[model samples]
Target chain A: MTQPVLEVENLATHFFTRDGVVKAVDGVSFKVGAGEVLGIVGESGSGKSVTGFSIMGLIDPPGRVVSGSIRLAGEEIVARDDEAMRKVRGKHLAMIFQDPMMTLNPVLRIDTQMIEAVLAHDKVSEQAARERCIEALSMVGIPSPAERLVAYPHQFSGGMRQRVAIATALLHRPKLIIADEPTTALDVTIQSQILAEVQKLCAETGTAMVWITHDLSVVAGLADRIAVMYAGRIVEEGNVSQVLDVPRHPYTRGLIGSVPSANPLGARLKQIPGSTPSLGRLPKGCSFEPRCASASEACRAAKPDATDYPDGSRVACFNPYSLARAS
Target chain B: MLAFIIRRFAQALFVVVAMVVIVFFGTNVVGDPVWMMVPGDATQEQVEEVRRAFGFDQPVYVQFFRFLADIAQGDFGRSYVHGGSAIRLILDRMPATLELAVVALIFAVIIGLPLGLFAGLKPDHPASRAIMAGSILGFSLPTFWVGLMLIMFFAVMLGWLPATGRGPVTTFLGIETSLHTLKGWQHIALPALNLALLKISLVIRLARSGTREASLQDYVKFARAKGLSPRRIVGVHILKNIMIPIVTVLGLEFGSLVAFSVVTETIFAWPGMGKLLLESIQRLDRPLVVAYVMVVVLLFVTINLIVDILYSALDPRVRLAGKSE
Candidate 1:
């Protein structure tokens, strides 16, 4: 089989503060094949966004990747210097920020910013770059791509701005696109449109994607596979139907159960019992022990190692679910 | 946008009229113009003659009306001490002051803007910190003291340049003389540097603060994430956002440069409007004094107007608001 498009092994990212070190992404391991949409679902501070940022080399000062191997298209990216990393970025890998305004500059016209992005990685003529910009914008469903390209960022609404940002990332047809909650800022209908467009474009280009979001419903509708993260670690990961329908880890089960659609109508939606453990003061055995309902004495004494299943699912739990055990 | 300009112009006209009213009555309340203009040994009849000639003997209201009428006709009356038309004297002195200010502004902006941007981009660097400290010290020192120090070093001690008197030429008409060429630059250099030093410090501080804020803006972070080089991020994205506030501070400081040049001109005895205005005030030349103040006020108003127009051009939000209104 061809090598996975992107692979992360034992990736650990930490934040150092006056208080202490926050283990944001303790040990996240995952892989995305070509044309695969892998969704990482977690609450705020679960390190979902940090994992994406780490892969993209966007983590700022005071927070850094402690130890990790991030291989993009079979090359180690974590060890590359800033210049090498930049070459990979926007060419082989690209990202869409959560806030659309952050992705677009208010002072510059769309054409100026988009064409510059195209010209940065390629030795293309201005006319060719302009044509590519229009095609990208139109591909994202923007009307009058030529005229709209001349307009500044503020002239567009929030959803339109996000579409433009996605268009910019798509200009190079990168191998991997890490979207850090890109749709969280948009309304539901717009979110659905953006997600559909993103999925269609990725499939057409055979691009791998890591979608970081807290919305399980979005993952259910869009992701081909799902990795459930809690307190900086992935508790369970598998093909979308296998994990979402029959979650092995208690934490994953609780998350799937908490979704409104999982509960009966007019009933109080089930909620995960406790908040995520603080990174600095995490439980010694398991980070999610305080919140998991099936915690046992052994689970309290030692962290569970990841156990692989025959169907390609992995779960880190002392007591995992089985069909016979459930009966 | 045109409507905004019209509104600003109307507001400026009101301010000019208010300034004229204050100058007219304030000069009258100070003392009798006749007594102040005529020689001390002049007889009462001659003093009365001077007062009648200026219409100072009329009621204060009538005198004010006549003053406004003369101003409207572009006649600023005659200078009692200089024995020339007040407007002509002021106009003659203006070019010298304006030249000094324009050159100093160019120097301050050229030096201060880059220094500020560099300091902000690399705040922890030793060179940036040293420049920040130096700008603070430069801003705190008085202009006259700075001028004196330059003269002592470049003129008195080294004897590399003349010590004083605008240039080697005694007559103002010989301003075009060889003395006013390269040597004249050496003569004016100290005063101009003194005037520019404080402004440089002001611009540096303002630009640094503006740049720091712009650097933190989301678009700057976005630019970084876009994989653009650091040079492009700092030069294109961050600098453009910072320029609005820096331009505002620079415009106001440039206007103040006109007024502040008075002290530098006095120290160096430069042939500028500030020096002329100081001489007129000492001699109680009321017409020249009023005319000088009006000129300064008009200059400040015009500069502020230009800044406002540029503000709209630089920021689309401002332009949109202007269009809406």
Candidate 2:
């Protein structure tokens, strides 16, 4: 395959707080090729969002990307200064936040917001930028894009607002777009509609996407590949169907098992034994060991590094579930 | 929007009525104006004659109704001490007080906003801490004492500025103002600064808190992610949001500055409405005092209305709310 649009390797984003260092996105690595959708599945505080922020170079003080190499289209992201990084952002990469209502500035008109997003990357005339904004808006399925552009964010429904956000992200046609649960705040119906629209946009535009979400079902329908995160690390990474049908990582298996549809009707829903461990003081061996049903003596002794399997799956475990045994 | 303003005006009228009632009764409680007008050795017959002539012998409610009717016709009665139409006496002084209040407000906002933004942006910096400490002094230091200290240092010790009075007056468009002259600004500077101290402190605190709160909002973070320059992010996005609250507080404060800048005006002998108010109260000039207070009430009502309008302009949500109403 050609070079991936985004490549993040051994990225360690840590927050230096008063109590201790929080390894929010410790040793996370992933790749996204053109038109590919990589869904990062994890619970809250699993560093899924932080990973996105790190890629965008939007991490504020008290939190720093302590160690990592993030490359966007063969350009090193971690090496750029703030000014240079800003030039890359919105031009080469963009972000779509979860809460659409809060993402757009309430006082600013949709056109104003989108026009600025365009002007930030391109030096085109305001009229030209605005036309691009209108085009982008209509591409996201918004009706009467020209009129909608003049309206403030409050005038739009939650779904429409997210569409506006997506339009803003697509304004520059950046190489990569990090969507951090963009549809999570909308109704389920709206969520699917947005999901379909986003999927189509990604395919038509050939823009790479890192769709960070907590819902397994969302990634199942949207992502070509899936990466399961625990604590702060991707414990399983593989083709979506391969990983879903036969999850090698115990955590991944547990997650798939816990889904209601995966279990027989009227049967007890399978659950992981315990909550995700805090990043500050994770277990010595595996971060998921305390809750892992197949945890072994070796799993308790040392942390497991990711190992590649023949079927193009990656599992980070000392004793991963065997596919033959499951079948 | 028109309905909103009309409703606010109605509320303002009610407030004015309440003020008139309270001010009349409250001044009456301070003692009869007729006695204050009379000499110390006046006989009962002489006092009675004077009281009847001034209509002071009438019942309190009757006096209130008469006063209300007089004000409705733009007749604010005569100042007992100044011996002129009370409204005229106050209106002549209005320009000075308005100028001082506006200049003081400008001083407060210009000096406070940037400092407050700095402190908010870099809260842990030593310079920010010093700015915060200076703001605390601005809040706690008595205005009169600050005025005195300013006089001592700038006027008495340095002889750089006039110690008292509004300097060379320029009449522009039938109104007397000291602003057109250079020496006039020097004279007004100390007094305006003294008046602005507390307000500067207030704006600093308000801006600081507002900035801190707004910087945490999701929209601000999103602005950064949009790759907008930091200057644009803070100046446009963050500043605009924080201004909503700051405008509100400063608008009301401007009214108070105009109405009750008594100590600064007195200390500096600035010859404004506040000084007029103080003298009216001291001499028990009921008509002058009442007129001054009513003017202040009008000023406050007008200011509050403007603030509400400005608030709607700044926030679209407020504009929509006004539309619905």
Candidate 3:
């Protein structure tokens, strides 16, 4: 029922490195509606972070969005020049990095950075920006935000610093936020706390979020929809609960089954048999063919098309669990 | 903060005291330097006057204590050559050296910093490569040769500026300084630029490396992600982070500029402390020589203190290091 804020279609980002060309994000597509939290779940190097970077136009040299269409509302933004992207960045869209220190300039005070971020998009005076920055900090549950504004980033704990990063992302009330493992470095308790706070924030503000992470439990609790990635493609995607309970694609199932809680007590967690395939030398057909339990000859011949089930789940596998059972 | 400053000052004073002892003994005890210090081929009367100068030629310890007492009152004894305050003569010459060093520093920073920043931003670009190659020449070429070439072109060939002397001295802030009028600027410009050549090269290398490293930091990426314009991100975010090291190097370089401007000063015939120092060495002016060495030591400590203060101000983490988390 909500309006769509982001639509990424057939996006492929690649790195033209000295050694070889790497398909960082190959033909990935997803959409997030207003207030919807779309969790992009995957192992490291699965193109999850690249997908986030591609959407934000944060790709640096040797790596670029080779072929893609990214639209915010109706604006085609994939190839927009940096000046134009500056207009869209921090206003229509924002990003949260994995490390808060990366977001916080060490020599600058928290207030200086936050106020500058506010002033970047708004034509407000410094007094107005300062007030807004303070309010933003408090909203993120920072105690004595005025004092915190004067403190340096290193003065704060890692969790508090990430909270500051989240606060900064919320400053413009951007339509979409691409957070690349923002709390993967935090303690578990801090991770849950940040997730809950952010979830509450999106619920209240109706901001769409793309949370890129390797943890399934994190997405299970926060996302409205989950997209499971393998190598550089979305292997399976569906409503979070449905995907977690009955993952159609073998990669998604293996991911869910590997979680300690999903396994019966004392049973060794089930892991996918082989490591993720390197994108440059991916196997023909399915990239996961080497590790697939249900892989058939057809699965190795070519990549399979994503099949839709009556339950509204999509799986990119030649022999999906639900389809196999139906046969 | 006051306590921290006081502690650092006390530490600095301790170092100065240690230096004073070494310099006093080294200069006073070596080769009958006092005898050497007596000018005009000391007659018996002049030699006796030297003894009376140390309080009736009091015992060495008595003379040392009296010397210390006089130093505490800002009297560095009288110059053997001029028979005036050695400290005042050094102070009189200080402003000229300071002016040249400061002008060189200003030119170096204003031109070198931005050039280095661009070079770092586009390290592989043709223009940046040219800048780097130019800096290599700056580093390798001799300063004396560079000074001669500049004089030959600007002074000899073009006849735009004067060749020598601090032209028509004017006093400002109760200190004598060269006139900023056309003549004064013309007089100092050549030597200042020549002295700056080496430092400009130093600053360029430092800024380039610092910019390259800081630009890759996460905060720089974050600045870009904030949608800050490229100018703002590089100018503010990147510049502030890289300035710490540059400031450190600049402080040390500034001290070297003051102490080592001897060659440039001699070449230009600019009457700065370095030139005065060279003259005092020839005269074997004991009090003046000791005072000059001590004054330079003092300059180094004071500069170090200023740099530390500036560092703590720019980087709060350094200021709050042991005080809080």
Candidate 4:
């Protein structure tokens, strides 16, 4: 098999606060091949976003990668220093944030922002860099690319702003892009348009992507594979269809069940029984056991290791739905 | 833009008029200028004659209108003490005060901005703590006392700089200044530094808070994510955002510094408008005092206008806001 564009192994990011150490991302492992999109699904504070930040090396003070291995395009990134990471960032990898309004500097012109981004990695003339920026803007479907370059970020609508951010992420055509709910703040129609644009860009450029979001429907439409994160750990990981159609983990089943569309019209939405436990005081056993309908005595004794299937599906629940069905 | 300027000017005019009325009545209530003008043993008729001569015998409202009329005609009357045109005395002292204030403000910004940026960027560092501590010291210590200590240390002990008075003066750009020569700089340095103490602390606190807030903005994070050098992120992204607030506060501050630098001027014995105002108030020199205050009010109005214009230049949003109006 060809080398995957991104390979993360047992990545754990912890925040050392005065209260306690909060394991934001603990033991998350996934891979995205060229042109493939991996959707990390989790609720807020479930470590999904931290996993993305960990790979980008953007974690600030008190929050750090306590243990992790992140490989980008066959290069080990965990051991790289800030200076080395900077060269890798925006050149070998890039990121798109949730709020486009905030991602771009308000005071700076589009051309200034984009041109400086290009110059940061490549030593190109201002005119040449400007041309590349113009091309990028057009690629994202923004009209009058040349004229738009001189406008500030506020001049654009929210959707257009996100498109600008997408264009910037694609400027270097990095091997990977970590998009953390990039469309979550946009209107539904604009969300679909940006998703389609991103999908096309990835396919055409063969850039790997890790799209972190809590929306199951978004993943259903965009991701090739899906990983369900619970309490900072991925309890299930598999091909999008295999997992969505027959979720092995009880938490995954609960997630799919809770989706309003997954239920018949007029029927009540299914809900997972309890809230996510705090990472600092999580149980020794399965993190999802507290909320799992199929939880049992053994599930409370020890944390279950992932059980892998020949079809590449993996579930970390001891008594998964598949096993119960067979019995 | 024209409408905005006209509106601002109208507001300024109204404020100046209101200030004139207030100062006119306020000074009358303080003490009669006739007493200050007459001798201690002057007879009642002599005093009465002096009062009639200066129109002090008239009612307060009548005197206020007369004062207003004199101002409209560009005649501010003579200083009872100096016995000259009050406007001339204020204008003559203005250059000295303006020179001192400008130099002090420059010193404050130059020293404060970098220290504040450093403290803000490395908030937990020992050096940052020390910088903050120094700023606090600047804030707490009285300017007069600090000026004396500076004189004692740099002048008396070290004998490196003069203790008091404006040094050898040179005229440049048709304004008298001590800034044109090396010796002049030495003379201005201690006084300016003394005046700048409070302002320095103010700017440091402003810049530090601004930097801390701007550093957390998503654009700054995005700049870092773009792999831009640290220098560009802080110098361009962070600095540009912080400058909006700093420029605004400093602009208003520059006006007050010019109008109310009495303590600093007294400490160094600089012949500035603030010192002149202080003396005029003591002698109950009504015309000069009123003229000096009116000049100060005008100075503040002009400065506010300039600050508004500069605000538009620094922030594009401000320009748009003006346009929409």
DockQ of predicted candidate 2: 0.78
Ranking by TM-score: 4, 2, 1, 3
Clashing pairs in 2: none
What TM-score results for chain B when candidate 3 is compared with the true chain B? 0.85
For residues A1-327, what per-residue lDDT tens digits would candidate 4 score against the true structure?
999999999999999999899988988888899999999999999999989889999999899999879998788998789999999889988999999999999888899999999999999999999999999999999999999999988789999999999899999999999999999999999999998999999999989899999999999999999999999999999999988988888888888989998888998888989899998998989888888778899999998888889889888888988745733
List clashing residue pairs in candidate 3: A285-A302, A285-A303
| DockQ metric, candidate 3 | 0.64
Which is better, 1 or 4, measured by lDDT?
A: 4
Which tens-of-lDDT digit does each residue in A1-327 have in candidate 3? 544799988899999988788898898888888888999999999999989888888899889898979999868999898889988888889899998766799888888888888988999999999999899899999999988998889889999999888888889999999999998889899999999999999999888999999988888899999998888999988899888887888888788778898779998788889797777877768898889899999998999877777776778888888745533
Q: Write the per-residue lDDT of candidate 1 for residues A186-238, one digit (tens) a residue.
A: 99899999999998999899989999999998988889999999889999999
Across residues B96-156, which tens digit of lDDT does each residue of candidate 2 receive?
Answer: 9998999999999999999999899889999999999999999898889999999999999
Docking category of candidate 2? medium
Candidate number achieving the greatest lDDT relative to the actual structure: 2
Stretches of candidate 2 above 4 Å error?
B1-10, B25-69, B173-175
Clashing residue pairs for model 4: none
User: CA shift at A119, candidate 3, in angstroms?
Assistant: 2.2
- Stretches of candidate 4 off by over 4 Å are A323-327, B30-53, B57-62
Give lDDT for model 2: 0.90
